[model samples]
Target: MFKDSVVIVTGGAQGIGKGIVHAYARQGAKVVIADLNEGLGQQLEQDLLAKGYSVLFVHTDVTKEEEIVHLMQRAVEQYGTIHILINNAGKFQHKSPYDVTFEEWSDLLHTNLTSTFFCAREAAKVMRHNAKGGAIVSLASTRAEMSEPDTEAYTATKGGIVALTHALARSLGPDQITVNCISPGWIETGDYAALRPIDHAQHLSGRVGVPEDIAQACLYLTNPQNNFVTGINITVDGGMTKKMIYEE
Candidate 1:
């Protein structure tokens, strides 16, 4: 459905970001893989290109304003305009509020929240000028609603993202642009599965989520027909948020 549409997926080299990139590419969208990991990004680009998919890898440090600005410029230079943006780049290190260092807390906030704002600002400028408008989907987490131990920084940043999404939606709606956030819960990525096998099974689905589950929600939000759905934080947590399971 995204044929010829230009889509940007930050952190598109692996995990959930990779899944989103593949989904958009399969639908014939021109994809830009923006991330800090140059090697992985280049490899993914080459692999997708070999499969006859239109993709580009731009080594971007989302926390840097100059790099984010350059990434947008490169996207426009390569594909003319961006029709969708997936703000999937984030950092999640476990640390208690009392134990977390100042630098660590700052890094998490900068990477997860501030960077999202920077990229959205730049993309909205271009999308407004294009007059066709665009869509933005940010990766949030269910921790924004329910928190676990040592997840203070992550939870705080994710909550900020939900608020940011709503505010942006209100401001950008006048320009015909839509902005939303997707909150994933207990996803079974390789590292996460290895880290918390038991907690992963506590979900109402009796299993953890996968990258594709979140990607599917992203596709729906960014779809051309879903223009009316904006400023909402859709939770893809397998109903975990609905249950009141207490851990003793």
Candidate 2:
């Protein structure tokens, strides 16, 4: 469905980002992997290229404004215009509020929240000039509403992203550029599976989600037929956000 479309996926080197990139590629979309991990990003690019997929890897620090601008420029240079942007780059750390240093908190905010804003703003600029509305999807977390221990910074950034998604959607709606947020629950990704054992019953779906689950949601939101689905935060957490599982 995305044939001839150019899509940018931040942090596209691995995990959920990789799934999104592969999904777009499968749909015949030209994929640009914008990430800071140069080695992994380039490797993914080469691998995808070998598979006869159109892909580009741009080493980008999303928190850096100049780097974000360059990322957009490179996408335009490679594909003429960007039709979709997936703000999937983020940082995760486990730390208590008391133990979290200022630097650590700032870094999380920059990586998770600021980067989304920077990328969205730059992409919106291009989409506006192109005179064709584009879709932007930001990856949020169910933790934004529910919380675990020692995740103050991470939760805060995610909450900000949820709010940011609506604001951007409202601001860009007049231009037909839809913006939405996907709040994923405990998805079983390579990193998540390595960090903890999967418990299917923990969520309402009787299992944790896979990266493809969130990617599919993103594809739905970004689909050209989904014009009325802006400003909404779709929770792909297997109904975890709706259940309150608190032990007293």
Candidate 3:
């Protein structure tokens, strides 16, 4: 569905980001992998290229504005125009409010919240002018609404992203650009074989979430046919968020 389209995926080297990149590439999109991990990013770039897919690895630290600008410029330079942007570069560290220092708090905000704004701003500038406009999808978390212990910083950033999604969507709608957020719950990016039966039973879908779940959501939100569905947050969490969990 994304043939000949340029799609930029920030933090597209590993985990959920990697899954998004794979999804886009498989759909014939020119995938740009913007990430800090040179090894993983380059490897992914080469792997996809070997498989006859078009992909680029641009080393980018999303927390830095200049690097983000460079990444966007490189994307346009390489692909003519960017059609979709996936702001998925974020770090999640479990730390209590009292345990987190000022520096740590700032780092989390810049990584998760500020980076999203910067990337979206740069991408929207290009999208607004394109004949097809564009779409932006940010990776948020279920923690934005509910929280576990020692997750203040991560939760706060996610909540900020949720709020930012609608704001950007409303502002970008005039340009035919769609902005949306996906909040995934209990996504097991690690080895699934390590998980026990009860772990899967805890979820309403009878299994923990996977990165492909969010990847599909991104595709739907960015699809031109789904143009009317904007400024929304789709939670792909196996219905766990709706189920009541009472301590026994």
Best candidate per TM-score, number?
3
> Count of backbone clashes for each model?
0, 1, 0
Tens digit per residue, CA lDDT, model 3, 36-131 = 999999999999999999999999999999999999999999999899999999999897778899999999999999999999999999999999
Using TM-score as the measure, what is the rank order of every candidate, best first? Answer: 3, 2, 1
Per-residue alpha-carbon lDDT of candidate 1 for residues 1-248, written as tens digits (9 for 90 to 100): 89999999998998899999999999999999999999999999999999999999999999899999999999999999989999999999897678899999999999999999999999998888766699999999989988879998899999999999999999999988999999998676686536565676677786788888998999999997999999999999988899976689
Model 2 misplaced stretches (Cα beyond 4 Å):
191-198, 246-248
Worst 10 residues of 1 by lDDT: 192-201
The C-alpha RMSD of each candidate to the native structure, in angstroms, is 2.0, 1.9, 0.7
List TM-scores for all candidates, in order.
Answer: 0.94, 0.95, 0.99
What's the lDDT for candidate 3? 0.95
lDDT of each: 0.92, 0.92, 0.95
Kindly indicate the candidate among 2 and 3 with the higher lDDT.
3
Instruction: Give the worst 10-residue stretch by lDDT in candidate 3.
Output: 90-99
**CA lDDT for candidate 2:** 0.92
Model 2 over residues 149-216: C-alpha lDDT tens digits? 99999999999999999999999888779999999987777655454334676677877789999999
Record all residue pairs in model 3 with backbone atoms less than 3 Å apart, i.e. clashing.
Answer: none
Worst 10 residues of 2 by lDDT: 190-199
